[model samples]
Target: MKPRILLVDDEENILKQLRWALEPDYEILIAQDEYEAKRIFEIMGPAVVTIDLSLTPGNSQDLSGLRLLEYFLTQAPSTRIIVITGSSDEASSLQAVRLGAFDYYSKPIRLDELKVMIKRAFHIHQLHQRIQQSYPGSAEGFHGMIGKSKSMQEIFRFIERIAASDVSVLIAGENGTGKKLVAHAIHNLSQRKDNPFAAVNCGASPEHSLESELFGHERGAFFGAYAQKRGKLELAHTGTLFLDEISKLTPALQVKMLRFLKNRKIERVGGTQTIDLDVRIIAATNHDLLENNVFDKDLYYRLKLVPLPPLRERKEDIIPLAHYFVKKLCRGRRSPPIMLSPEAEGALLMHPWAGNIRELENLISRAVVLSSHSVLKPSDLGFALNSIPTDVNLKFAKKAIEADFIKKALSKNNGIVSRAAKDLGISRVNLYELMDRYNIQIQEFKISRSSERQQMKTGEVL
Candidate 1:
């Protein structure tokens, strides 16, 4: 089907011109007033929208367009929006972009240039869709998980293979490695993409509230249950329910979960009727299911297809994942995507990534805020690079050279301390303590070559 574009303008001449320019290329939705625009918005839900800056009482002002922009963006965050403004409306145009408009066209609009702007808007929308659909699971996949490690790719493959199935999935990862995205991907790929993919963080919600949120409540289900309300499970019927920190489930809740897993049914709080569902279930945890032995064996078996390896082991995928997040999180914002300079990328590579992908994402976001140049610098990322070849001071030259020497020795040893120490003409014990002192991750000291080429072919990244 042809993508739809809702064209909102009070002037008949401008609407006619746009319709003439774009109707052949798109399905045009024309709205002459705010009321008409809203009506079209509710019904058509166009893929993109174009609104003029002047559509009020005098039909020649900026405020009307700004208000409409806010309403449209609020209504549909993913929809591409383009604003039209007069030559004098430079501040309004930038305001539009800040308000989340994709781009603004200065009027009297040039037809061919306007076409390019419209095309770019569509391009942004398509890229967003791709990111949402095929995000590889892991912290790296979220805001960029750390390490381009082989183990991470294996996890990616595992997620891809299982995303097509309706079987319950269990994701096991370290605390900060982003197990939730894996759960999300599975939900998105399953047969219920259109339905709500409701998620509840088991560890975050209190026991009482968790129960109420999961199964909902009747008017008198609990002390605060003033009115009957639908639970996450009910809202997620025919879709997917993602439970995070699954290991945190209390013993009583575990029994409830196991029953639902086996029976495909739930009873609302204080309600007697059993509700059968086709909702798919995905569970995630920071704890090792096999190690804790607290997870119900039956439920664990039902959920487990196996766990994804941690980010520290996935060295090969780190850079690509970082690039993916840099594009997603920074681009087209008040501060657009800042390029990672060679030093910045190297600094990122050198870190142990203790918090894994989540940590990296936070760093990148912070860097975007701090960076002065178009290219993000190491200092912008808040890391004191031992390998800093270019600090403002020449006084640190000796320290930099020593850091380089230590790094070279570690590399020659293939992460074997004894061998690296021998190569450096130092004691293995000394080297071990030195590496720790410098915060070097011996296991990930080197970058992975021959990157994983396969893009996630499974569920979308939403």
Candidate 2:
């Protein structure tokens, strides 16, 4: 069956024309009034809808369409509602958009233009539905680190293999790539899960204080040493110590770290007593220790290396990670799960993500809290349509649209590749080729439907 599109308009001719123009591509459900529209909307749950700003035949100031718009949005926030208004009523059309209408078309409807807009709306609706369906549990793959890309899956397997050992591990990644989270995962997966995991930033503290902060200090060790205190190394005895930004450590501190790794022993400042500790060291650095002159070769070589790719390097994980943040952050809110519109998802994908996961998380959190509508659009995510680069080649744009269309078709058919191919008017082999080319996972779409049905049974949205 074709995707449903509810058309709400008072004019008989207008309704007939839309039905005639859109019926070929959509299952058209016509509503002559606000009441009929609401009834049909609740019953059919159309993915895309069109409503006139003036629903009452004679009253130019009825505003009933606006009321219906709000009602439809409240009842089914995921629906893509396009408002139909006269050219003179641009203000009301804009107001409808503000009230959560997806897009607006003027009175003199150009069937061709409206058709394109409607297709785009359905595409967006499909994307949001896919996200709502697939994203239920946390996206965290291993020990609270979120990612499902091949790179991250490999990291998960690697962490599991090496976590039980007591080797000193070095994690290298750009800032905000979650090196610290990786360290924590290793520690939690290891036998030291029950022990305390201590963390210290090598570059955050002053040089004079960093040594004492790591190796502890006895009473009266310095002018400010009012009492004896155990440092991170001593405090993490029999557990894990996370040294963040290890490349920033000065030469003197690096030597101290090397010595500690060698014998697992430390000497307190201003005290002769040597402390023997049983602790595991997990050091992280944003800089490339091999290329930079900031790190000691001997110390770097002693730590087993784990490198993390930046967010842009793993584009496949962006959407899932975004949805994960949306669900996680909206748990405390009274409303249902906040959704990312197609444009928002595209913006997230196109972004360079210079800050990696941290940047994405912050954007989603802010969107969840600040977005007026339950459905988050590009503006809610602090991205404008103009922000997308316009210099792209025609081939890339075609590929993007093609992939989106295929995904929608698959989603509409509940991931039955054969049915989806039929719906798309293509052969199974051709569809499979497209899916493979775009790395589209049919099983994920299939899983999304099951998960959505389960969530619906429990009265959980997304």
Candidate 3:
């Protein structure tokens, strides 16, 4: 079917002329008044609409056309509306655009120029539809996290499978990758969801207090202990205890934790009574547990590891996640749904998200709050325009492209050097050599498979 276009103008002659020009390329729907335009818009759901701002016949006193434009946009934001205004009415034309009109034409009606605008509007509409369809759970989110990348989808599946299990889970990722969110997801999906989910940041407090924080202290246990207090472990009984920055745990705390896991019991700081509790442990760290000797080897072995890759490794999810954050942050605000312009989207995709999901969420939230325009442009995002190179040197470009390809291959094949090498039509040895040259670690890709096995063993999935 030809794309639908709605033309709204007070003059019959102008509407007829536009219909004649657009009929061949589009299914033309003409509306001479506000009522007719709205009726057609509601019934047809046209992809593009052209409205004359001076809709009240000869008076031109009423701004019904602009009101109608706002209504159509609020009702169906995906539909692109182009405003038609006299050359002198620049202010109204600008206002129409600000009210979410796709574009505006100064009328002495250039049929060709109007046609080009309509075609572009239809193109943008189609692109928007495609983006909406491709991004799964973009609005609803998955386990309090927003991403539609293959790696994230895998993570969602793993979470579903392991959430009900009683085993200890160790989530490893960068500082802003939402490790705590993952811990929440696991608890929320588990049988112990109704129970309290206690979280403790091991790095947030002093070493002396860290032990008492994890394990309860009796009355008069310390100078500050006026009354008996339950620590995170005790409070999280019959629930999940999220231990953030577990890598920061002091040696004394680590020994206490290891003992608790081994014995399924904990002793209060000043009391000899051994307390038996059923608590699930979910630990998170931004450090590499195997490479870093900072974490206890025995404790690490006791927990099932779930590694979250950095955002740069999952470039495909950037735009969708940004849109998700925009919708999330803009909720309850007076403005309409904020949109990302093409340039803004490009900037989001091109920039290396060092802080990962947390960084992206913050950037988008700030943009939504600060930007006055309905559409969020690159300037609104506060990214330095020079951050992404405009002029690419051939040698650097070639190497960059090669590195991206290698990373993608490794990611797609689950970071197995042999599989990635075969997929890239190279030997495993050659792949290893290239990876070494590029400073790529094979271990980054291995987490998916290992997590999958852990999920399966825990009956997270069939």
lDDT of 1 at 276: 90
Per-prediction TM-score, please?
Answer: 0.59, 0.56, 0.59
Residue-wise C-alpha lDDT for candidate 3, range 1-462, written one tens digit per residue: 678788888888898888889889988888888887886675456788989999875666789999999999875677899998887899989989877889999979888888888889989998986777466466657755876766788888888777866789999899798898798778867877645677888989998688888897999998999999877788788878889988888877888899999998999899899999998999998987667576678998889777787988777678778877888667636468889877777777777888898899889888888888899877899977677566433344445556777898886677888888988899999988999889998778766657777556533333
Taking the tens digit of each residue's C-alpha lDDT, what string does model 2 give over 227-303? 99888888788888889988889989999999999998999888799999999999998887867576788998788
Among the numbered candidates, top lDDT falls to 2
State the lDDT of candidate 1 residue by residue for 147-251, as single tens digits: 344455556666656777677887777866778767765655655654557778899988888998898888998888899988888877777888888888887
lDDT of 1: 0.72
Question: Residue 121, candidate 3: how far off, in angstroms?
Answer: 44
